[model samples]
Each structure stands twice: as structure tokens, then as C-alpha cells.
Target chain A: MIPDDALVTATWDDLIERDGQALALSGNDVSLLSELATAAVLFCAEGDATVSAIAAHLEELFGAPEGADTSAAVREVLTTLQNRGVVSITG
Target chain B: MPWESGTAFRVLIVDAGNQGRSAVGERLLRRHLALNGIPADVIRVTSAGLNADDGLRMDVGAAAQVERLGGNAHGFRTRSVSAAMVEAATMLICGTWWEREELCIRYPRARGRAFTLSEIAHLYEELAVAAPIFDHPRLLDSRLRSSEVPDDFDLPPWEEFEERIVAVCDAIDEATRWIAEIWASMVPHHPQPKADGEEAAEPTCTLDAFGVAVAITCGGSAHEALSIAGKRAWGRCVVEDREAEADLTIVVDPDPDVLADARLTGALAYQDVDTALHHLSSAVTVRAIEARVGQLIMMHAAGLAGPDGSVVGFVAPSGTGKTTLSRTLGAHYGYVTDETLAVAPDLTVLPYAKPLSVIDALTHVKEQWGADSLDLAPLPDAPLRLTRLVILDRRENGPSTPVLTRLGHLEGIAMLAEQLSYLSKIPGQLHALSDLVDAVGGLSLLTYRDVKTVLPLMPVLLAGSRR
Candidate 1:
């Protein structure tokens, strides 16, 4: 999980949505992101955004899917995005 | 895609003559990268012209704009766009659609990587800054239909490239309208809009063949002239029943203002009647194929049926005389389609006898002529069947007699795959294709020097010929 105050930024050029799904492409590599993941990516992409700010924005755009561990899911998405190279997190 | 990756990532900006737009793009992109702390050595940005005059400086107006935009264009010299440049460039952005298309047409391999300056700029903004995405509309919809699974990730490289090229071609066309509108707005005193398409309606016609039918509704200015010309050119496909249902409906209009408005509204519009009809042939053909994308096995080949209904489909590249053979041998057989021939799994041949686009040497325009107008054999009442498939191998100093060499299973399928469209969407697509190859016994490569030499082989090569 990314630290609450860590800097988060997007590294993709274009996020293309095709057939109800969004994909962020880096060179030939394309990563499929869900709707929540998409919103989180946009939130974290803004300059000086932190993990806590990204979760708060997600809280507004998408509420918890009825007792599904919302913060844990957001953390999971951030971790995946970082591993996918679509997002950068730094202390 | 990484800024500091060892894999070389070069972006090449292009325009016709390379004097203005491309120079601005090159300078601006370089400055953009620098502003973001990306080293110039990491990402290479250059510009070229399709037909450049080797050593020319950036246009003065463009250079001034570059300076105004806080970018230096001090030593920018135009370089001719070459095969080497296209090969070296990871991304090629052009100033106009014509340049993009011409480059793509010349080097189909670059089809996937080519983009317009306007398009790449939008991409650049997002790439560099991931600029506060607010659900920006995707540039182009996926070429795959809604039903296709999201497994588009697994497409072969060439197929992916082809799809990207098609998608980009369409997207670039749409993007160009925005560029034009922006230019129009920038001019303080723009010309007033032209009159809309409000002329009296023209005679409507129903065209049906190959199980693919279209109802042509004539509207707009010059509709009467265009309608009559279309009717004349596609008379072979026209039927008596005007009320017959069609698989597709196309509006034939050629009003300039209407065309311009259509472009703005994301509709297919042509500037003039000739242009409309010229593009209509391929557009309609593809539409017909789309209608039966999964239902039929279609190929870019010419089909002709002998008297007893044995139809031989000949696959050949452009300038290899598929049309010539269709027109010449068609006198003694039923002419199907010179462009797209469709077949059902049961071997039933569906004829798409659209007007042939023949090159007129004098005017150098490809004139469309109906099969009946050209005295080509008409579609007979006898049911047509797919009897044989022949790939034409034309050569200058070849044998006097046409030799039919039987092709192997993999060789035939691989060669034929290059010519078919929308096959991937079909269920068991390759298996279906292979079944057709096996069902028809096998395919043959017809190596010949002249059409006359290939003529005699038809009666023997094709089943039910002269029956």
C-alpha cells in the first residue's frame, strides 16, 4: 500500500476507453482499468496529489460498494497501477 | 514510453513540403520535453516533408509563431520524408490528413504509428502531464464491434497494426475537421456559409445483388445528376421493385455546404458527385461486407461463373488485372464482383456486381462502368457455386501457356488470408476458411504472361465451364 502522504502522478499519455472499458497505454503495453481505477488514476494524476487525497476523491466519485472494504480496494488499485507503470508514487 | 528508457523512442513530425506546420511541431515538442525536465538526448524530435527541397528553412510566419510560443526554431532545416525516416520513427505526426494518408498508403507498415499534429498534441499533453483527466472523450472507438470480447489485446502484430491504421485513418479524418474549424475561427473575416442541400428530390433506385442490397435515396443539390449517373454506373445491381427492403441505405448528396456541415457533424460527406461516387464503391463494398461479416466468407477477389454455374474466384493484387480478366472472360460467363466476392459456407456464391472502376488513360480518372454498359455477361438464373480459387501470378517474361500449380493447405490459407476482411470476428474464422479451402478440393496459383493465355485454361480449370 502507498503511504497516505506519498506523491502520486500518472505516467500515461492517453487513456483510451473502448467498449465500456478504459485502457491506459504505454508504448505497446496496454493496461485495462476498471471505472473506479480510472477515476482514481485521474485523481492521482493531478500535481501534488497524495494517496489520501486520491481516496477522498474516489469517495466522492464512487461510494463504497456496500461493505467491500473501500480503502483496501483503493490501496489495491494504487498498488496495481504502480506495478503497471501507469502511476508513480514517491515519498 | 519511459522517458529515460534505453529503447530509442523518436517522434517525427511531417508536412507536405515541411515549411511550416511540421517545423512548429518539432520545435514545440522539443521545448515541451525540455520544460518537463526530459533531456533532448532521451527523446528525439525531427520534421520532414513528403517532397521537400533538401535545404529550406522554416517558414517565416511559422518561425515567428514558434518564438511567440517560447520555442526556438533557429536552425530547423527541412528534410525529405524518406523510407528510412518512416522506419526510424517510433511516432510520425503530420500536419494534414492527406500527408498522413499518403504516407500510410506508401508505407502501410507505418499506418499504426502515423498521427496528425493536432492528434499527437492532445496525446502529448496527456502523455507529459497526464493533465487532470476529466473523462475526455476517446479519440476513436474500437474498430471491433460491441459484441467482440475485450480480448483485443491478443491480436497478432500485423492484425493489430491493420486495425490501428484503419482506426487512425478514421480518427485523423475527424480530427482534421477540428483543425479546419479552428483555422476558420482564427481568421477574423471568414466567408459566409454556403447554401444547404435543399434542391428538389431526384429519382430513387434500389440496388440488390449478392444478398447485399442498398437503397439509394437522392437528395441535395445536383441530386438528379448524381442519381442518374449512379443508376447508369450501377445498372447491373438495380432491380425493378423500388419497394424492396435493403440491408443498407445510402443517401447520395453532393452539396458543398451540406458536405461541410456533414464533416462537422461526423457524417460521411463528399465535396462533389464524382468524389461521392468514387469513394462510394469501396465504402458500400465494405459496408456490405460488414453486414455479413460473420455470415459469409468474403475475399478481395474477382468472381466469374461459367454457363453451368461453376464460379471461379481469382485473387490478385492491384495493377495485376483482376478487373481486366473479369471484364474479358466475363463475356462468356456471369460476372460477379471484381472487388469483393462473398460465399456462404455451403459454397453458394453471392455475386456483388458493382460498377467497375476502370482507369481512363486520357483523363487519368478511374471511371465507373456498369457490367451491362460494358457488355459483360449478366448474372444467370442458374444458382452459382464456388468451384475453384485461383491466385493470379502475373509476370512479363513468363510461359506462353498458363500453368496451374496446386497450392498446399497452409500456403493457400496464408496467401488468401492477406485478402480477406473482418474474418477474425467470425466464429472459428481460420477453421472456416480452411474448411472452404478443403471443400473446394484445393486452391491453385495461376502463373501466366497474358490474359489470352489464361483464357483457354478457364474451361478446364473451372468446373461446369461450357456445360
Candidate 2:
């Protein structure tokens, strides 16, 4: 699991949200992701915050759907963002 | 009928030197006129400053010029002409940029009449390259003159500034090309008169890019311009032996530092070259009627495409962290406008992705992404397709998880109302603003304290949201 303190810096061109849908710009490319992933991506800037803390915060604020594997989902999303260099996992 | 039609008018830009640059600019002007196919009576005034004359007469002179142009002839006074003739021609009127602080204080009317600080900056650029002030070709480098530097700034090391200046010359040429394109789009050839009876007189356009009428007499000094703040400019008259009347005029105290910053690489000044071309478009002689237009929706902000073809948009009010958020997206998502997203007559949103303004406060992005990765260029270069409007807000709380809220069209309209320029304008502008709102979805994004908070949600947002 990536520590919340990990500094994840990326260059984006634009950010768009329509109806419940959203898109993000990173360099010249665009990515379509779920709202949960959207929240997770933004959370990458939290220093020393754990994935669970990030997820819990999101759940409380956005009222994420209950009964889903929130931690697992957060982990999965963070790992993907890690691979893309949009975020980093740190102690 | 995008804007109210204007009267017939003309402008002449003469450089002190480098006939080549002047020639290039003149050619573009002519091409623009031809493309518009508007018939206008134009004459060139080749002299420099408040004096000197190169007699190129036009059909309209004196009173006719005053009626059509301005009532005064200060704009037309030439050093070559007699003072009596100059006065008779009303040639000593103040042009827009000629002002002093004291004059403005003594004359409150001058406060808002002069050109904007930004506009004046742009005008200096046009004049600097328009003609050589002197007979010599001096390289004007932006890097050497910043507000921090001295007035008579020494030129920077040759190799450093040389490449950038050359690039600027090329960029200027490109801007002229873009101007030609806009002219072609706006001007239609006057229809030939019917074979049977008398032909109709086609009206001409007379406004500049800023939406101000070209015939409005811009004040002579900054103070005077400000004195008439918010008032329509007075018109100018042409004198037979003097310079052509200038609707607007600008003068500046040469500041090497300011000049240097303006010439910086990847600066907006580079793009100003292109914007000036738009003003020239308004003068196209093919159609004599001027169009009063202020808005130029440079690009669409939504419907951005992902690597896999998914699309989204980044929305935020001006000065919001929209650009910061955008540049942070990096290679992950496609970008649109940092300012506006031009929506087509159809529902589709076009992107106007331009350079993102990274402020001094946001240091983390630079730390994470190497500085080179963050180097942004001006707007003319960045273009993207938009999918949605993600309005970003700065919340004291750290980056929040993305919230997917749905808004009705009416609600969307309400949210978008704040985005248009000049809400106080006529009913027509208001209608256009409302129409734009109906076309796009709306969202309220509260930014968290940490960048990490938003990183986890990228893939899902890229994938699209569910109701």
C-alpha cells in the first residue's frame, strides 16, 4: 500500500465533469475513470495518509455506495495510478 | 447577425524601418480585405510620429472624413504640413495612448478612456516590429528587458536571445496566416448587382477585435483617454496633406524590462501577433460593414478524449485551480481550453486547451513532475476535444473524493451563468450565454488539501460516471 505522504505530481491539460461523468487531462492524453477513482486520484496528494484513510474520507464525503469492498477498490485504483506515474506509493 | 453592424472605416499602420515587416503586414491586410470581399476606400500614411507625410490620397477628405471618421484631424497632422493646415484639419487631437498621471488626476474623464494596460503592451509589440523606429535593425529581445531591469538595457548574450527572436519572427508570420483564415470565414463577397436594376450599396464593418468601433476617437493621452472613460470614442477627420486619422492611438515610455518580459519565450506576446491579425480582419475592404464582436470562443473545454477514446472535461471558474488541475493531469487525459470551451451550434463541445497558468503557491506539482514537464506554452498551440465541465473549487479540506452529482439542464444553465464575459451587455449577449449553459452539464468539485486525494479516482472518472 502506498503511504499518503507520497508526492505524486503529474501534468494535466484539462478536467471535465458532465452529469455524473468526468474526464482528466495528463500531458496530451485523456483518461475516463469512475467517480471513486476520481476521488482516489485526487487523494494521491495527501501526505502520510493511508489508503484506508483516503477511502474512508471519500466514503464519508461523497457517500460512496455501501456494501462494496472499499479498501480493495482503493488499493486497485491506487496501484493503477502508480503504474501510470500519476501517483506513487511510499512509506 | 452575431453583432450590430458598423460603419465604413480604414486604418494605416506604418513602421519606421524594415520595409520587409511592413510589407508582410500590409500584404496580410490586403489579403484579408480580398477574402472579405468588402469594398472600402483606403489610403496609406507612411510618415512616422506626429509629423511627416507620404501623400497617398483617398476619395474621402476633410469634412467627409470627419463625418465618417472623427471630427478632429490631429490623427492626420503631418510634420510636413503647416500648423495652420494641421489645426484646420483638426490634426492635433490626442490619440488614445498619450496620457500622464497628473492629467488623469486633474481630468477624471481620462481614467477609463485610454487603452487597457494589456492592450498597450500589445500595441508596443506591433509598433516595435511594425517599423524600425530608426533606420537600424535592432534586435528586440524580451529576455533583456524586464520591469526589474534598467531602461537602456544591454542586449543579452547573442546566442541565447538570437534563436528566440528568430522563432518569434516565424510565429508572427503564422499569426498572419491565422488572421487570413478568420477574415475568410467572416467576410463574404458583395453579391453582384442584379442584371436588371440598380445595385444595392453593401454596408461595411467598422469595429476592432475588442468590440470597440474603429471610428470611436480613442483619446490622445492616457489621462485624456481615462477622462472619457466608458464613453464612446470621438471620431477623427482626415486632412488632405496630413497623416491618416487614427481612431485609437498609443504611446509608451520605453521600458527595457517590460519590453524584455514581453519578448520572453513561450510568452503570450508571441500569441498577440496572431490576435492583432484579427483586428486587421475587421478592416477588410471587400465588405465595408464592420461587425461589433468581442467574444472569440477559442476552443471547447469538454468532450476530452482519453487514450482509449473515452472523454471528459475540466471546468473551473477563472483564477480557480483549473489550469493547475489540468497540468497535473499530464499525459493521462487530453486537454481543452484553460479559459473557455467553444460549443458548436450543435450540442458538441469543442476544446480550447491552451497554456495552463501555474501559480507560485502550487509548488508540489513542480517537485513531483520535473520542471521541464510543467513548461506550458501560450493558448494558440494547445487544442483538445471536450467532453464535460469539471468545475474545480478550492476547499480548505484536503483533496476530496470525486463526487458524481447530476444536474438538470435548467440547473446547468444556472451554474454556467457566471462563466460568460460581460453579463451586463445587451439582451443578445445574455441570450447567447444562456444558450451555452443549456448545452453543457455542470458540476461542483471541492478540491482537497492534498494532491494524493484526487489521484486514486482518475481511472474511474476516465471511464465515465453512473447516475
Among all candidates shown, the one with the greatest TM-score: 1
Give the range of the ten consecutive residues with the poorest summed lDDT in model 1 chain B: B128-137
- Residue-by-residue lDDT tens digits, candidate 2, A1-91: 5554443443333444445533453321234546666666655444445666877877786775567776666667776655433455665
Residues B224-319 of candidate 1 have per-residue lDDT tens digits of 777888889888787765553332222345455665544333223444566557655654564455457568887768999887788899986434
Tell me how far the alpha carbon of residue B381 in candidate 1 is from the true structure, in angstroms, after superposition. Answer: 2.1
- The TM-score measured for candidate 2 stands at 0.30
Error of 2 at A64 (Å): 43
**Taking the candidates in order, what DockQ does each have?**
0.02, 0.01
lDDT of 1 at B118: 56
Q: Which candidate's lDDT is highest?
A: 1
Q: In model 1, which runs have C-alpha deviations exceeding 4 angstroms? A: A1-91, B1-203, B240-255, B264-268, B464-467
